[model samples]
Target: MRAYRYLDFITALFVVVLIVSNIASTKVVLLGPFTFDGGTILFPLAYIFGDVLTEVYGYKRSRRVIWTGFFLLILATLTFGIVNALPTPPDQQSTAQAFSAILGLVPRIVLASLVAYWVGEFVNSYVLAKLKIATQGRWLWTRTLGSTLIAQGLDTGLFLLIAFYGVWDNALLWTVFVSNYVFKVGVEALFTPLTYAVVGFLKRAEREDYYDRDTNFNPFAVR
Candidate 1:
């Protein structure tokens, strides 16, 4: 395996985004007319990061990174669960209650997050990789934005449905799903230029513009 200049950095950021987003998702926030989880604000960046990884390093490398984020997210969930279950000191009982109020929802949120992210990210990478080859890597924008449009829909709808379907009423659930999906895709569209710049820089600096021409598309494959 060849070493890259920024793969580790990008992987670190991607995992951080996944873990933070899962934790933040415990709260549903309203911004103007849009309603979404607090995680929605940062969660879209994970997709952006995914695009960059697949575009610059290829889907195989991106697959490893995705699994890294997935396992770390599970570890975070376990950590929160263990801490939440521990007995609190008398002086910190109230604080523990507050912690429970917030992070207590993390187990379920993490479950929803794990499922959604696993499926959504793999689809995103596969689409972008195929698009890169089909376009012969000509239109970078198409691959990034196109893949995101599909992946974010899967991610947002699955997560919202699994996490809040029964907890929130149907109306609010639909509203949040639409809001999150639109906002996430809009963010991808809005950041097209920045993505171009980053992808360009990485390709030059790393001397890598990977195309998954003969690579396995299996999500569980360990090649």
Candidate 2:
């Protein structure tokens, strides 16, 4: 495998975003008319990063990164669960309770996150890759936005239904689904220029603009 200066950095950031977003998702916040988990603010970036990775490095490399983020997120979720399960020192019982209150929902959240992320990201990468080939690498905006359109829909609906269906009332669930889906896709569309800059820069800097021609699209392929 060829080494690139920024791949590691991008992977690290992607994993961080995945883990932090899962943790932050414990809180349901109302920002004006928008009702969503705190994590929604950060989660859209994962898709954008997915777009950049596929656009520059191809789906195979993006698959590895997606899996990397997925596993690390599970590790973090397990760690939180374990830590919460441990006995709290008497002096720190209050803090422990607070921690439990905030993170107690992590298991379900992580499950939803893992499932949605695994499926959604692969689809995002796959769609973008195919779009790249279809357009002969023209109209980067279409690829990014088009992929986000489908993938974010799957992600938002799955995550909300899996994570909050019974826990939240139907109205709240529907509101969040609408809000999160719109926000995520809107964020991707809003970041088109930035995506363009990063994609162009990475392609130029790394001398790579990978197309998925003859590339395996299997999500489980090791290579």
Candidate 3:
């Protein structure tokens, strides 16, 4: 499959944002009545692109983008850990404090996040692409929402379990699990019409609508 030069650029920028957003996500802020993580805004955008990549381009291209994001996350996590380990200068105490607050994440938590992201995103792309074919390119809402529901469910449950399973009580873990799952999918569900609009616009603008009738579907092959 030939790459649209513009799409490749977007994918690169998207991966960078994914890394920075993961670090930024360590901080939380109140979004009116509810608390929201910084990553929430951009993370959903990534998934939307994940849907676009698979739906419009095919899973192979989406797989390449997913691997790019996965590696970038690993690199970002390692960079933060390394920088946090170094001793701080006497005058740089405040800088160190800020860095610790913003970028510092435990290795285990980072591992959990990486693992969850890799599996969740690929599954999302795969399911969406497959459904797109099975449905004969009909019911865009059903495929996008249905795949996100399942994919986000596994993502939330796995990440919470890996990152906070024993740290939080079972009830709290389950509470967070259910709440996060609902929130993520709710975010996608609320944006369903937007997804439809974007998909329609992209397909028309790009003049591409891939069915993946002959895709390799191998998770390991980057090509």
lDDT to native, each model: 0.91, 0.91, 0.79
Which run of 10 residues does model 2 get worst, by summed lDDT? 102-111
Q: Can you write out model 2's per-residue Cα lDDT over 1-223, one digit (the tens) per residue? A: 8999999999999999888888888888888788899999999999999999999999999999999998887788788889899998899999999999887655677778889999899999999999999999999999999999999999889888888889989998998899898888889989999999998999999999898999989899997
- Write the residue-wise lDDT of candidate 3 on 4-75 in tens digits: 735786687768767866776676554544444566556766677788778877788888889889887888
TM value for model 1: 0.97
Residue 133 lDDT (model 2)? 95
Off by over 4 Å in 1: none
TM-scores of all candidate predictions against the true structure: 0.97, 0.97, 0.90
lDDT of 2 at 188: 92
Once fitted onto the true fold, the runs of candidate 2 whose alpha carbons sit more than 4 angstroms away are none
Off by over 4 Å in 3: 28-38
Instruction: Tell me how many clashing residue pairs each candidate has.
Output: 0, 0, 0
